[model samples]
Target: MALPLVPRAIAAQPWPALLSAAFLAAFGFVTLYSAAGGSLLPWAFPHAARFGVFLGLALAISYVRPSWFREIVPYAYVGVMVLLVVVLAVGVVGGGARSWLDFGPIRLQPSELMKPILVIALAAFYSAMPPRHIQTFGAIWPAGLMIGIPVVVILLQPDLGTSLLLTFSGITTMFLAGLPLKWFIGGGVAVGGAVPAIFPFLMPHQQERILILLDPSQDPLGAGYHITQSTIAIGSGGITGQGYLNGTQSHLNFLPEQHTDFIFSAMAEEWGLLGGIAVLVGLGVLLRWGTRVAMDAKDRYEMLAAGGLTSIIFFYAAINLMMVMGLAPVVGIPLPLLSYGGSAMMTVMICLGLLMGIDRRTRRDRERRRGL
Candidate 1:
């Protein structure tokens, strides 16, 4: 009986996804340890602690029924929107963005919470809509409202990174819901055409970022410093790396946000191209697992929810990687699980927990069908 119970419990868990997360989190811990000048006091310990706590939260969430998520999504969305408004009114200003709500010992970024909730809300919305109405404007406008409203609020917070992330996740869901492809193509062309008109209205710093992206040397000591240092660190790594805890840029304080937004740069400096590839491969495994969950979903809600949630992680990782590599403008996006921040970790773990729950449901349903 004891032997049977051991395998049964082990078989019940999603080990592949769990192990992948563990690998990334452990890598992040070591990188953070190095970033702290070989100390764990500032960043390294807290990061590991947060991952553990959030992982537990995710596991608890995994046991929840899918119907419970569908039931709470509307209320949860409304609640988060309220928090965003609260943030605008009295939020703590950090890194030049008034995006956090102070609660004595804790500072919460409501925008992070919106990522997962928006996915669930949209998933519920599309799953309930009539199949015949999916192709109609009725499908398009309501979903747009769901996405657009929060985006406007976040922009008021002036967090361009979060706003862009929300837009991407929302649009990904809309596409997954079977919105016409021509709409996306037309919208893309229109947005592209409108960029010139939009350029002048952007904040000065925003304009500088775009300009620097086009020509980093134009402001080598100013707006382009972050990208310049990041590239130097990455390029210096070459093949294997400079060796653990021996990264010159980070240890010497030349790499800004070395423990957070630019942690990858620090890792590559010490761990080399191989370390970068290891991170990529780990993320790839997790992403492949997520895509499989979405494809294996039994209901429309589960499918959209899994796909959208998975896309949120993808966008976070992709934008941060590109931003560091100079392929995109700096927008302050943090690498998921690897960055030294609780808010993003919580949001991501919530998504993973929800995905786990959906995957569990999918597996059980398959077994039931087989039993019949």
Candidate 2:
């Protein structure tokens, strides 16, 4: 009987998602290695090392009880909120955003931590709420406050990428909670009308980036340099890529932020279209598994949390890809599991871990219901 438990245990783990994550990380390691002039010391080694450490953290998180997550949601949200405030007070400035808390060698971005906690908080709130109240002001105001507070704080950090991500993730949770669609539609209309009025108030660089998006050639060597070079790198890697480690754009020092925000462009320049498809397929598998977990959740909280977590990953990957391809403005969002950054890697892994735990509970609940 004890021996038979071995295969059962192995089968219970989320191997498909794990394998997909590993594949992406390994691909990223290779890309970073190439990007660093064949040296692993700077980019490649740390990329792989952080993934290893965070993957362990994810596995540890998988073992946590779902009830514990619900219990900690409020404290976690409040704690991250405090950290965000602290960041505004004394955070280190990098990439023109005062978004990181520097503790000697360890740098923490509280905004990244807010993404999942916000999901859990919203899920817990809605799960505990009476069904009748979901359509009332009680529902909309509280959830809006939860999203708006963090967003306002982050925007003060002048980190547009993270603020948009938080807003989108929060909206995803609200939508999953069965909130009325008309509110979202109306909000979209309002935002659309407000954009024109808000344009002039934006920072000069921010306004220039938006303008550059429309006409890159007008400022190809200035504000548009990143997009122009990224486009060339991606376009040059037509089919099979320019052959790994031989990407002209990156190797020639033409690609900007090749190890972070534009890492996809660097990979594309070397690995080509086939490499891009491979990355996409890996992400596709991971996302499919995450969606299945949400669909199979036994309770409302689980479903909402899982959906929100999955959306976080989706938004990161989607935005990064679009930014590199010049389809979206460069907003400094890194590709999940593929970019060289500890903060994003930690956030994504935490999401995966939480998702796995939720998936585990869902399976166990199903088994119990069936008298397994």
Candidate 3:
């Protein structure tokens, strides 16, 4: 049955998650304003416009029906594949990765959009099957095949970070869909055994990234420069931060990619640990709300969709934090709302909106069943 738009006799809707998202969005805007203060109007206006557009799109997506979402998943996945192929054919090269499709005035990165689409598609694909069917190697091969095609193509673009994210999202959705423990252990063992033989295929730069993670000092001014300077910025923040817009590391260009992939370093440098904690708290609230929605999901598809979305957000938060703290190799993953880029910011917003829509539908169903 199609769930109603609103819960019967319910006094209120979930505003905490929406409010938390709003606060984060505002925080991002302020930081962007500060980060791009000196850039020309032409350069800055596009970002600002993109932000506004994404915010509205998120709000619109929040009202969509769960059934509609399910129907759209396969199409969305196919659409992403088409765009990926298009990107490979005529992508503009930048930052050692040719992953962005150039559309003259605007550059589009399809991988960012593909993350959530892949999540939804995988969730729906798995949830439709019988649990017993998926437990064996025969049934799991199709699932692996679905994931492997895009993964291989994306990796051919040489976008290791995004390819990893895609793999992470797909595997997580599969796990949520009901994969057995033995499967995980077996997969881990396979990966462990293959790492040695497969290590030689990694690009030289990719190898350098792993080595820099081990000892950053080896190439202080080259591969390790980002980590070294980021650590300094984070440490310089001390406890309370150096204050907004006054960060020497940020303003003096000591920290690279201060507005995009490494924006957290700027936050740490300017707002210190306290500010970082604030962002974490906001993210925590959003995550908790997502989990609650997933638990209350009216069906397996919704539950899996909600869970997969939550995992994507969690992965970005955890990976970005680790990268900024120098605890993990820098993977060029943006810090959700805090980082710049239209595709990433929009994708996260869409995920939150999807969560809200799912919550709304489930609540309505509960109310209807109670005759309220």
Candidate 4:
């Protein structure tokens, strides 16, 4: 029953998942179109180009063997960590945050790279350790170091969003690796206790964001402007939306970062409740499919990596949506695939590539089992 030629490869690819992602990117491009007032130069065109480039990149990476991925995880983590140090030494300041590195042609955010790299490192670390050592401090500290190094670096970069993502991805991987619940609870308690100590070190805007999250009305026109504007935009969009290219808040300059983090509000304004639901449904499909990939993985490394990758994706979608809806602090996390930023686009596509690789591997395994 084995088939020949290009269709064989096509048959193995996850068409459903890829199609789901494509629908989201397309819908997002439409939103970006409105954000740019019907122009494509500023955001939509470049967004499309980057999506094509990164999607192709992900598809190419899908061909890499699982064993090869295992070999590269540690190296990738080390490389990203080094880039973070370089960022610290010579990073550029944007939006009052020193998180990007200027390399003449392209400004890069190395901390974004750590989202996937950190997960891979932690997954590899736990995969190598014996299960008997799971509850031991010996098991805990090394992984903590793996997580802490980049976190501290990114925090100094004062990029709370990326650091939180890295920590979440790493911790989730450890949980999947069989770490006990009590350890997680104790860690949570310790974090709560240490918040007072960490508060002083927070940047002014960071503190303002937390305060804004607590009560946006405190400075509705100043520090709380973003959330206030964002909520207004979202609420104004009734059921079917204001229609394409007709959102007043974004087009009139009332919504900040409309083409980036707050694109969702603009989108909701134009497309309405159904449109918002559509975007969430598409992402939910991707998430559910990704989780299934982890469940179907053949080994511990595959399982941990797949689940960790899914967590990274989930964290971005959940956080960005929450931030826009006034449920969480605006730490500058962008909506995956939808937000207009190369760093987030690159990170999300990499995760998709890893998922593609896992899904492809699963198919190959099944085919082999049937003696195809």
Candidate 5:
């Protein structure tokens, strides 16, 4: 009897999450409008249009059956790997990274797509393996390969931001899958020890960003320009903000990447602390729904996918906000759904869609188990 109503319950749960996403996108559009000096032609319209298109694409992706997701994981992971290789051969360069593939009018970033696919593939891999193996060398090696291969490929593209995001997403999934806590502690120690050796290999600009993070005053007109200008913009906006479309820093061109990576600062300048808080609360709502779904997930696969995807969104939101405000080194991470870019919009929406897929599968599994 209760099983029959499960479908309706699942359908109703996403309204708050969906509304939050739309609202964030709308706020981003308005910021882009201001960023363009009150013109929609350049940034706002395309941003909104892409949101609509990806929202629809996400819906379609959500309908994929569990069996299909299982079957597609290997092929999807391999296909993205091939694209990563192709990118090394002839990838288009822009803004300091060669991560995009150009095919006339359509430019695709496979690394962006891989973030979520990595979640799916790893979840699928762990789902098939015996739970008992999760703590052994068997589980560690394969998962490390799944994560390490892409990290190496993208790091070579010199897109350190995306590589870190993938590593975070994959590791979060593994931890949630119940790997031994001591192993993570040991890995953390190893990673900490490796930093000294790895620091020299970092790109000059990347190293500069870290130095700026350490001392913003060191290169006020050079390396520190971004975060310095960004903090000013954020601090200028008081409790109620300077009013929408009235931010001076961005309008006067003091803020860099005002339409992309630093859009949140643009938003903070106009919307103020209140607006920032609102964005946080809104994203909190979206993530909360995902957390609930992950916690109540009906199976191991769904649990890992839902939880991993949720962690991925959290990663984007946290890193971008921190980078803009100077709490972290600038790594060129775009705010999820809010930043004016196609690649991130697609990645985040697919995450939401996949969560919806998990919800849908959870209901079906529940119904079937009850002989409904």
Candidate 6:
């Protein structure tokens, strides 16, 4: 007879998720090692400490139950929204944007957390509704209202990249929850057309970015310097990198933000095409598993949450990769696992935990259905 599956085995171990997490942590340490570019000992200690903290957070999240995740969606959404408002009121300015809220010893970026919170809230809202009811106009307005609040607040922070991400993630969840394709495509076209007209309302720097994206050579040493350096670093890496820690672009300070947002270019410069592809493959694995979870989900909540989380991660990864590859503008979005930031690390870990919870619950519900 075939052996029965152990709960330990059947319960989601989240290995793909874990692998993605490790690749990020390892890449992070290496990037930080390159970031310091000189002090090996100090870089080693702090990098290890951050990796340990993220490790603990990831493992802790892996153990959380799905029901608990469901129960706390409303509370978490409210709390995160409050924090976003607080960030606007008294947040630290970084890269010409105030996206961080100070809380004594630690600073939090509610916008970072908002992506996942919006996902969960939308999932919960949709799950509570009757199947066909959400398809009607009545349900769509409240959902739009729910997402609009944060989108406006985040945009008021003048953070276009994150605001766009939040809007995309929320709408994606709604779409996955059986939102009509006609509405989705129509809304997309309208937004696409409206963006240019709205461009003038953006801050000068934001306007310059769009302009620069259209023609990167316009101000090569000014607003365009970052992408210019990033492209050079990536191109110089060629098929094989210059070798880790030996990237002249980063080590000599030609590439700005080498340790944080632009680390992909740094890695590409050092490890070349193969290394970059490895990171992409790891991310692909995580996405595939997330899609599986969504497909196997027992209810709309699990499906929507899993699908939304997947899209959030996918979009972030795509944007980061595209920016590094010179295929898109430098929108100042961080690579999900590879970028260095306490807020992003925590937010991503929490998201992984939510995914684990949904996957585990879905597996259990399936086994029970089979009377296993």
Tens-place lDDT per residue, model 3, 1-372, is 887687743335577886777677666666665666555243245555676787678767877897787898788888989988988888887667878888887778888888888888877887788878877776578778878888888887888878777788788888888888789789989998998887788878877777798889999899999889999999998899988878888888888988887788887888889988989998999899999999999899899999989888888888888887788887788888777777777778888878878988898789889996
What's the lDDT for candidate 1?
A: 0.93
lDDT of 1 by residue, 1-372 (tens): 256646755688998889999899999999999999999979999999999999999999999998899999999999999999999999999877899999998889999999999999999999999999988989989988999999999988788899999999999999999989999999899999999998897778888889999889888899999999999999998899999989999999999999889999999999999999999999999899999999999999999999999999999999999999999999989998899999998998999999999999999898888993
Model 3 scores what on Cα lDDT?
Answer: 0.81
Q: Which ten residues in a row have the lowest lDDT in candidate 6?
A: 38-47
Kindly list the per-residue Cα lDDT of model 6 for residues 1-372, writing each as its tens digit.
776576656445777777777876777677678767755444445655766786787667766776567798788888988988887888899878889877787877889888888888888888889978967987688889889999999888878888877888899899988877888899889989999899889888888877888777889999888889999998899888998778999888999987667889988998899988888888888889888888988777788889998888888888878887667777778887777767766766777777887877777777898997
CA deviation > 4 Å runs, candidate 6: 1-12, 38-47, 367-372
Every model's TM-score: 0.98, 0.98, 0.92, 0.97, 0.95, 0.92
Query: CA lDDT of each candidate?
Result: 0.93, 0.93, 0.81, 0.89, 0.91, 0.81
Model 4: what TM-score? 0.97
Candidate 1 backbone collisions, by pair: none
Measure candidate 1: CA RMSD.
Answer: 1.2
Ranking by TM-score: 1, 2, 4, 5, 6, 3
Which residue runs does candidate 3 get wrong by more than 4 Å?
1-13, 37-48
Clashing pairs in 6: none
| Stretches of model 4 off by over 4 angstroms after superposition | 1-6
Error of 6 at 143 (Å): 1.6
Q: Which of the predicted structures, 3 or 5, would earn the higher TM-score when compared with the native?
A: 5
> lDDT by residue for model 5 over 62-122, one digit each (tens)?
7887558778889999999999999988999977999999989778999998998999898
Minimum summed lDDT over a 10-residue window in model 3 is located at 37-46
Give per-model CA RMSD.
1.2, 1.3, 3.7, 1.6, 2.7, 2.7
Q: Model 1: what TM-score?
A: 0.98
